[model samples]
Target: MVYDEHESTARFLLPATGVTIDILPGSEIEVEVIYREIFEDGVYCKHGRNVADRMKDEAGAGGSKQVMNVKALLNVALGDRVCAAGVPFTLFPRHPGNSTLNPEERIRVQRGIVEPYFFEGARQYVVPMTTLSDVMEERGIERVDILKVDVEGAELMVLKGVQDVHWSRISQVVMEVPDIDEEIYTEGTIASVKRVLLITQLLKKHGFMVITEFDPNGKNHMVYARRI
Candidate 1:
């Protein structure tokens, strides 16, 4: 259960797996150089803390700041769109996909990379976005066998935030899609098509059985739904 829209935290090791990157915000050398280019060589270990402080010391919990309070770490009840959650829609400088800068010091700015180092005093965080029925009703989590998603292109806002009666308890799903055809309005349609044909018709209208695997050269695709 990791959600990185940026708040920052890290911990990893692969050969003998173990990873934890709860939240992401930026610059700790941009979160240890983008997960050390996606893992390898001293496999991460930023720590930084308060990612619930182990369920708030196993429930002796006093005012959870599992991510800066306000019903954070979920306890629900947030309306008025959570008091207009940050309105800075777009200005993404892009590097390691969601970079706010420090991609090797914005490539050691010679003369080109200086636009306030991609937001010198950048500030815009709203973080409190959850779904998959608010984390399977806040972690009672009956089932989710597998649900690997790579949010580079926001993969259909994380598969339409699951909930067609919890998409039949989610058997499997391995996302990372974006096979081109950009039009992006999705559930409202704006035209062009192929985001692997709208995530293989939204997991074949929920019954699953989808299977795409592009990248003959690279538009990046890899959808594989199950529950058939």
Candidate 2:
């Protein structure tokens, strides 16, 4: 498989190896929302601006859709608020839960300033699935409508950190998952197809049904699931 010279480009050029099967839209989200803008796009970047604009537009008049974006370094379109967190990571072989970064890895990730390579570090504080909930609760976030997790290969791990009680609070999930096998990674630590499937099953058990699967590029699959 060919790898994109740049991380941002890869997001659009990669070939999708997995399939996104659609199910049905579940319920409406009427709570606080969390958009984990994991990787920072860039300062002065319109990425976040555009998202915020669209969200506000959709929300319409009197819509109380507050968003919290957790960032790692890169800039993002500002939202209701922003929080700093290390990139979440775990040893390969695909675990069932999440892990934190060691001191060394934390330093590296904080300073790496690069793509897939930074993800290859020893440890990082990238927010974990549970952290999202923690931040929400800390901010008195009672209900959550949408969670857009696009954290490279750690998507599955992020989901693993969320529990049933927390799941009940979530309305819709938009996660970017790669076709495990086809994903072009220099580090070879990306979650495997088996792992991604396990995540899917976990979501299913939690009452989420896949509503749509589409290739954002040819490399990764953007999955949208809603509570049923």
Candidate 3:
């Protein structure tokens, strides 16, 4: 199953993935409203500004299994919020959901200076938010043999929401937790090494043997976990 809030890009890129990823109109973007913001394109650099475009141009490989596309923002908590492409004021996945964020880190994110690689954009839209556990229960999903997650920096939030699913159903997990997360490594926490331990520890707590030998992007480690 594939879950992405942006319908147009999701359908456009995963055309052959085989699922109904219809482009939801702007008004149909959310079921529950969160907050609203009108942003000015304050791009700091070209690299950061075009990050979203780059993702669209580079579609990931898909498996042969049947795919079900759901248009909703994946978060630990569910809500209706703005989720736009190239917009820095939102999609702060690096946020650890904790107060560990230093002043500098907080400032950068607040000013739309941290994500999309720190580039601000002009697009804006609301995204219906939901969690994996909620979706599983809603769909009556009982088992997931292999789970793969790569959400820039919201890896922990997604995993945390798995709850019973991770403990009972999922047999193996392959994910990429971006080590560049500013919130993942906080005060006195080393960014390079300790960041990975956080993921290893989480899986271990859930009765999984973990491995991280394949890190395609040196900054983001691809973690493999199997029920022991």
Using TM-score as the measure, which candidate wins? Answer: 3
lDDT of 3 by residue, 1-228 (tens): 122544443222222334454432332222111111111331111112222332344343343433444445443333122223212223322231211113333333334322443222223233345567776777777876566665545567667677654367876777755544434556978554545677789899999888775444334566778788
Residue 113 shift from truth in candidate 3, angstroms: 17
Ten contiguous residues with the weakest lDDT in model 1: 42-51
Candidate 1 similarity to native, TM-score? 0.24
Could you tally the backbone clashes for each prediction? 7, 14, 1
Worst 10 residues of 3 by lDDT: 30-39
Summed over model 3, clashes come to: 1
Question: Which portions of model 1 miss their true places by more than 4 Å?
Answer: 1-124, 135-150, 153-174, 177-210, 216-219
* Candidate 3 stretches greater than 4 Å from native: 1-122, 181-193, 214-218
**Descending-lDDT candidate ranking:** 1, 3, 2
Comparing 1 with 2 on lDDT, the higher-scoring candidate is: 1
Off by over 4 Å in 2: 1-130, 181-193, 212-217
Task: Give the distance in Å from residue 158's predicted Cα in candidate 1 to where it truly belongs.
Answer: 5.8
